[model samples]
Target: MEPQSSLPDDLLRAAPKVLLHDHLDGGLRPATIVELAAEIGHPLPETDADALATWFAEAADSGSLERYLETFAHTVGVMQTASAVTRVARECVEDLAADGVVYAEIRYAPELHVESGLELEDVVAAVQQGFEEGMAAAGGRIVVRHLLTAMRQAANAREIADLAIAWRDRGVVGFDIAGPEAGYPPTRFLDAFEYLQRENFHFTIHAGEGFGLPSIWEAVQWCGADRLGHGVRIVDDIKVDEAGVAQLGRLASYVRDKRIPLEMCPSSNIQTGAAPSISEHPIKLLASLRFRVTVNTDNRLMSRTSLSKEFALLSEAFGYGWAEMEWLTVNAMKSAFIPYDERFRLITQTIKPWYAERMSG
Candidate 1:
């Protein structure tokens, strides 16, 4: 961990942040995973909590997306039971709230948790129950919304889309398709995207993280995604000169012109080898060009980071300060998958006012 001098604990501890991307199955507590695995007779990489945490972090940082995703099997294995799902979801809420997140949108595939004969709705209900419990027990106010993800490798996109629409007014805020991005293009889920579009439901697509500009192009042009999840490789579409002049390719120009929100998970991007390192992260390039870039923790447990840790990394890498952090926070708020009225209310009533007070002090 970097020193807190650049991003003081005072600022990080109190920063009212908005999180756009996170995974439910990817953020379990190591000790909780161990106990849950024990109850279900599921073997774990390590019996000790600290060692297990280290194991997960190391496995995810191996520079191979397939290897990084292997660590999730243990977490998802223990999440098949309803009680386990509820417990993890509630704890996830408490953890985010404690980390000073005022609002968050967490996504996970429900089909991955139905192994023990639980129906799809049962899976969603269990997670919703946990979110309710966590919010009630939160040390402060925290609002959480669920985003249902359909695995690209699986043939359940239509079902997941219907599930998202079913839970729209209940708790599900948006829909997403996550998994291998190379061969399985967003066009494979045409029916699902069409259904969501007809219903006017919000959705985001995982794009341009492991893949390149073509994947991002398909995600926007073909899929009509409301946001681009980890659209780091959109940088591949940018051409820069020795004089620091930048030229945007057609795809990059379209993304910027359309103002599609880019869900940039900086640390996770580096760990996944999406960017060479933090200094060359597309976030700096995209932010400088005024793309609708929002910062996030893609998977807190796997990445072993929080919103604060993400900011701390950005601060050290880019020399960020209060103003930069504030702009990023507001960018996230603007690019959120919520209704305009609610987004404005959060900005004016929650985010802006809180930060304004901090600045005045």
Candidate 2:
């Protein structure tokens, strides 16, 4: 018998999901943004929540990564104060929990939140506090962790890396660098990556999305990234012939051989021009080749998606069944920056049993 038949929207939403590439600032609720913006007197392009949401989706649909990222100014503008940051963080967890996310690593740049004179540590503390409150509200249904990101174009990666290490024991699980990838290569943050390595910390770099193979190469071979954020562009090194055979170049071979996780956000990738569309996305080929591919909602508000919505879209595009869904979910859990035992427990205890029941039923 087949592992499963069709994936209904309800089943997809009920599946236990693990997310690794969500952005804290990028996933705010529409109403939250309007409320916070009004309280802070931050001017917005659209005053109504529905109109603001539409504006974000429309503006982020620009085909350039830089232009797509320009939408963050509004989200980040409303998140300057501590209470605003905490409320956004808490709501993020609540939203993910409602969407059936069992675990998630929400990333944001602390340096960006310091525009209102909040210290880096203070920003981190506020986020952690909100996470704790959200988790408490979740009642053990979902677990959330922070991945402190340093803007790749900035000069404070080392500082952010140190901040991640200091909070490593608390709630911050890893580190990352995110920004326009064309001008700022991962090597520019070599000191931070190297420091994280020396300190025995984990990190994932945003590469192979806005830029191509060189950025991915430097992130993996040079910076020792634990994962590749939005790594859909690794397909650049993969050549396919008319006979339907694919040849992997040195970088692609290395990425596959080492089992580096690729956090692919299908809808968000289409928005940022990483992939032309979901049907033609590299994720189809990469996952077929078993390249440790994992699905994610890079930015819920921008992409107008959730973990469930991403899976639903993939199911429609790729004819994915419960088996494929389970594989992708397991891939994410396995690639999480959390400890091996924790990952194993969640995979074996939580993720596996649910999929097994669904398949058997």
Segments of candidate 1 deviating more than 4 angstroms: 1-5
For candidate 2, the per-residue lDDT at 123 reads 96
TM-score of 1: 0.97
Against the reference, the lDDT scores of all candidates come to: 0.90, 0.93
Clashes of 1: 0
User: Backbone collision count in every prediction?
Assistant: 0, 0
- Give the per-residue lDDT of model 2 (tens digit) for 1-361: 3232378878777899999999999999999999999998999999999999999999999998998899999999989899999999999999999888999999999999989999999999999999999999999989999999999888999999999999999999999999999999999989889989999999999999988899999999999999999888899899999998999999999999999999999999999998998889999999998999999999999989999999888888888988999999999999999999999999999999999999999
TM-score to native of every candidate shown: 0.97, 0.98
- Lowest lDDT sum, 10 consecutive residues, model 1, at 1-10
Worst ten-residue run, lDDT, model 2? 1-10
How far out, in Å, is residue 135 in model 1? 1.0
Q: For this target, which candidate reaches the highest TM-score against the unseen true structure?
A: 2
